[model samples]
Target chain A: MHDNAVFSHKVLPFFLLAPQLIITLVFFIWPAGQALYQSFLIEDAFGFSVEFVWFENFIYLLEDPEYWNSVRVTFVFSAMVALVGMILALLLAAMADRVVKGASAYKTLLIWPYAVAPVVAAVLWWLMFNPSMGVLPFWMDAFGYDWNHYVNSGEAMTVVVIASAWKQISYNFLFFLAGLQAIPRSLIEAAAIDGASPFKRFWQIVFPLLSPTAFFLLVVNIVYAFFETFGVIHATTLGGPGSSTKTLVYKVYEDGFVGLDLGGSAAQSVILMIIVITLTVVQFRYVEKKVQY
Target chain B: MVENRPWLTVTRHLVLILGVFIIGFPIWIALVASTNSSSEFVSGLMPLWFGEEGFGNFRRVLTNEERVLGVSVSASWMMWNSFIMAMVIAVGKIVISILSAYAIVYFRFPFRKTCFWLIFLTLMLPVEVRILPTYEVVASLGMLNSYAGLTIPLIASATATFLFRQFFMSVPSSLMEAARIDGAGPFKFFKDILLPLSVNNIAALFVILFIYGWNQYLWPLLITTDENYYTIVMVIKRLMSAGEGNIPWNIIMTTTILAMLPPVIVVLGMQKLFVKGLIEQEK
Candidate 1:
């Protein structure tokens, strides 16, 4: 990692690194340590008493049905988001990559949604599905079905999933498009010269070449769905309608902030930290392999 | 590109057109809702056309101070808070990360690798995972309801530092050697040569970080109990929950448009830099 030439300094380098180090220690490290430590203790809501019950929190969480439900909900939410978001983005990117004209224009239209906040996205979808005044429900009523997310748990999950996935499609599309462009043109043309049909060439060459990007996006999208979809849950469902839409991250907020269950919330945080660390490790390992290849 | 068949070209255009339409549908609905009067949304489906109360809704949402439900501040005040928070975060991250990255790249020091790893650890610990403890720390420090509470904790970014480090590594060693031969000290060389070269990276990072800071929701929600300190993004949630039927859909949509306007403008106006920043940071 060293440069061929470098400046020699003792105290100055320390000073240069001080601001970032200090902020990281204070905000990130300390809080994470506290979460780890507090997860072992059970205290009353008012902070009146505390008992060092080392594994009780973990044991209780393991046996808790609601916690298990949250895990199931999170998996479903994350899988749906990753699948829907990546498929739409892959389809659009493949199309945009094929067209020689107006590519940038199509990109501009497709990518602006990346800038819209998740909460705003949730609000947009919420407005569209608002049973009475919403356009989608109005159309649903025109058919034989009724559409109300407020009362239907499955519908609540669907709306949150759509809103979260919709905001992420732009990001995935950019990456996939970049990946598609990076594929050597000669390889595809060579395939074309070998009497391979367009669909055959794509399946045999382009799709296989795009797998790395697909895997990377899969990890990124799942992490996003797990953590960043907090806004989507907060704005639309609040994990409501009998906790049908409550993901793990949302449950942590609910139990910690609103429910005032400190020990349980801290325990949940530790679990989330483990999940994030695993995902990040997987991402970096794959990224390093990609670099080598 | 290998074979330009007319039918293939038509199919490609059709697929892209349909994708654009689906992507644009929600936004179009929001736009339509923002232009109409609230009364129009009482019993029927939302109108697709603009109504007579377009500017009236925006003006009321922007300047009106009367309490609707949970909103205690005007839309303009919330927007201002959001702007300040975003600016400080974007600038603070660049300055701190650049300095640290410079240290890691150009100089030799004790605990250098230790510092780098420590900073890298922050990337794994996002705010959402440790929200309760972080809130407790901020509360104990009495930083709640203050700009410092809103921005400082969020400014310590591992991704920004990594980006700057990657950029600094690519700079030629000759520049530094020449500057050293010219008797330019570290600060002088940095100011005269390094900063100028880093302008594009800084601009790209600024656009991405600005959107990131502006769109923060849960952190601001936890820290800012005072209505005056509420950011536009957080305040909108309050507006949504306050008055079920009494909440004006038009005004809420107007606030949504205003909230997303700055970041959207930055993305569209600086599309290239944004794409560069986004892709580079991920790398």
Candidate 2:
């Protein structure tokens, strides 16, 4: 009964948490666990009742070349998006910081890309990048590059990466600008007084202080690349140009929802979860420790 | 003032202007696209300015088979469905996370640290991992295609819990103590004292969660398959691959513009809240 008092104290909290717990278990945990479990099974594509076929879905997925391709695709896409996104965001944020006036107006303009839905952004870019009529293509042909994302896998991948990065750079800029503003101005002044070159001061002092924020954004940008940018890929590339841009998430959508291979798709989803969890664990256990608390 | 450097200042302004134009141009395209007629769009050329076809395009988008929302394609049904679903999730998350955070942060509690880490585990196991089984679980519960199935499964928001804990931990303990000293019960102390202080966080959290829920394509696509149950995003996606007869760029752009409204409004409206909440990195 002594333990009951603590429970009683939690009565109010229990009420508050109950709804969240119930919903989380229902919507969040259940679907994910279901996906993981089904990854091991082979279900009739048409019907619900089926024999419990264990590990068959996974084995089949392993043999399917597309499955392995998706893993590689997910990696390359995420790496490119995350790395390029961080650099662009940092540069833009740095530039924004140096503006003498109308900083808010500049930020508002800069963040407009983030405001558009991924579908709209993709479509907007699609229209603007259309080879015959797209502004970029139209302008580039004046210089004779003959750029078109529709036919070339590399070009398609480049478009996907650029679009994803463009959307994300605004978010990163917001985070980094906030981070930069939070940094003490005195440190930079001191570095300048010591006759440190601007680049050296940025590398040594500013970059180190920005590590925690960078670390936080690394996790965010990685996840965004994994889950969020699927819309962009779906709308923009449709995993096209010979499956060059076929990301794991896009594959999951195509296989499970589009192709009716729910079991096999679940297997890929499980792999995605594993890669992300492993990355996160590594971040917390190793990289996070080095983040200077 | 006499010491001001001209070259650096001019260079900075130039960079800022270029950045602004890059970021601003796409939106200009979207806004302009809405104004364009189908003929104008297909003519292989569109000026940066408006085209006066907004009404006509809006009509076609809503009436076309490709219409993703409203009474037409039953996507409007999904919008309301999503709005309700997201609200339920938002309310559930905010209440649970804040109270849980309050329990751990403001009070002496047993196993509080363990609870913290346990909740954090959800952050690792994403909805993507367990989505298939959760589908079965909902099906088993006979909640398939039901409102409960759509809303309940993804309700445990690790992000909300995490943010709330961080916010609550920063709150001064003296306030809680004073409320307790005033004979306020735990409930009163929590409700009367704690919840008010966290309103800004709640607002920020609400916008983020709402947008996340609103934009969800995979989960909703997987769970609800009925024509009457598609979300706004689902509609846009469904319209994307339609036959050549239905791929009207004008209508697509119009509906796309429509779909963009809620998140845009939410973000623009709560700009200050989001700005305040998202603290910049300290150097």
Candidate 3:
């Protein structure tokens, strides 16, 4: 996309582009290159010696059960978050679209959680589900149920999923609401006049029309759940209870920072970068398709 | 509007109210927790209403009147650090993005496509993915525990640049042509016409970027070892892990509220621009 009328200054454009280019090189490209280079080299204990190893770190990761566990955990976590968050947001958005009064008020109230930081959201949920003096645990105790994320792996996953999904609801809700409002009203009216129940009309007409938005949000939510929820798990669970809740990103941090495994962490970083590139390509393809339509 | 369905309307209202309650429940609990004293949580469930200790808890947390876990940084000081970080990031990103977008759109120079692709490549390299090396880079540059380390690396992303580029492409070519015919240089044209035309977009991007900068957790946590550079968001982890046995729930909750306040206010106060910026930037 180029503008026809232009300035013919040679050095001026470089001056304009210098800041962004330099930062991209120093902070983004160079670091990424280092990760790639370091992934191929292994550092020994005590930081004394370095050995060149091609794919050994990746091979080690592939054979390691712990790494597999993290992969499975990340999948489960992202799937749960994207599924729960999108469904709840869709339900709320459908109801919000139907209401004729105080719609803006409801919209305002619902979307503010999007602004809350992931760590802050985690703390809020942690306070609620705390086993000792939390109200929810107290209420559940009366019903003959125990709640302790501290020692329970499944309960810990549940806590992180809830907190992460809670923050995402507002984002998905905004998009779904915008999608719903964009459909021509006459289509729904015609379906209703043809003796279709509201439920039938929604499934037949509205849901199909909303699929593109749904697909777009699915990708966004997956990326978010994968990358952004590190803080959520870090603040509350720290991927604890025997590494039950450690996603790939958290595993990288854990290995690199806490465990001091350089090559392995760099390899993990390389893998994550590949995932992000693939997702970015998918997102861009969808945007291009939307443009074509 | 299409049919006479009074019962359906009532159901919609009921569902909406319930949804709002579920969304608000956690924050309500956090607010309630911030109001109570530590001893109040010793033997009972969390209080459902306000406690008499609300004002004192907030005052104590804000003023850093007492030391907890041998560290006594004020909530106010952390918030100020957060504000400064957010402001520099938002303004820095906007200014940089605008200049790059302008150069790409209005002028065709050698390696223009190369520069555009270089910036685009960054979309695939989030700070989370390359954390260790990025930290090493910042450390090698001696930017650790400083505002530049916290904000500059983050400002390198291409989302804002892409948005400005899209907007610039939409501007009529006749505006630039007319300005050129009137003897206006590139700088004068940009300052007089382009800057004025971009106010709405600048404001919208500012809102989104400010929230983004303020909510950053892992980057700040990694680089900032100095207590003075701690941001409101990252400091919560320290607060949680500190004070081994007796967790100061009241003070932590108070800090959580203070951390959440600015971004929530920004979102609510500028809901329209925030929504528009979000949807457009994703494209």
TM-score of 1: 0.98
**lDDT tens digits, residues A1-293, model 2?**
11211223644554545555566555555666777677777777886766567888778888988777877887888889889989878877876775658888777766645555565567667667766556777778889799878798888887777778777777888888887887788887887778876668778988898887788788778888887777788777899888888887788778776787777888887888887788678666654475465
Q: Taking the tens digit of each residue's C-alpha lDDT, what string does model 3 give over B54-172?
A: 89988988888866423557788989999999999999999999999999999989999999999999888888999999999999999999999989998875999999999988898
lDDT of 3 by residue, A1-293 (tens): 34559999999999999999999999999999999998998997477999999999999988999999999999999999999999999999999998889999999999999999999999998888888888889999999999988899999999999999999999999999999999999999999999999999899999999999999999999999999998998888989888999999999999999998999999999999999999999999999999999
Lowest summed lDDT window (length 10), candidate 2 chain A: A1-10
* Deviating ranges (above 4 Å) for candidate 2: A1-13, A46-60, A283-292, B1-3, B59-71, B74-86, B106-118, B140-148, B243-246, B280-283
lDDT per residue (tens digit) for residues A34-144 in model 1 = 999999999999999999999899999989999999999999999999999999999999999988899999999999989989999999999888887888998989897
Which candidate do you rate higher for DockQ, 2 or 3?
A: 3
Q: How well is candidate 2 docked (DockQ)?
A: 0.41
DockQ of each: 0.80, 0.41, 0.81
lDDT (10s digit) by residue, model 2, range B1-283: 1124577667767877877777667667777877876666554555567888887666655454344233355434555776877687667667777776766565445555665665666777766555556666777888777777676666676777767877766676666666666778777766776788888889877876776676666677777766666666767666666643344565566667777777777767777665555441111
**iRMS, model 3 (angstroms):** 1.1
Question: What are the lDDT scores of the predictions, listed in order?
Answer: 0.90, 0.70, 0.91
List chain B TM-scores, each candidate.
Answer: 0.96, 0.84, 0.96
Residue B100, candidate 1: Cα error in Å is: 0.8
Candidate 2 local accuracy as lDDT? 0.70
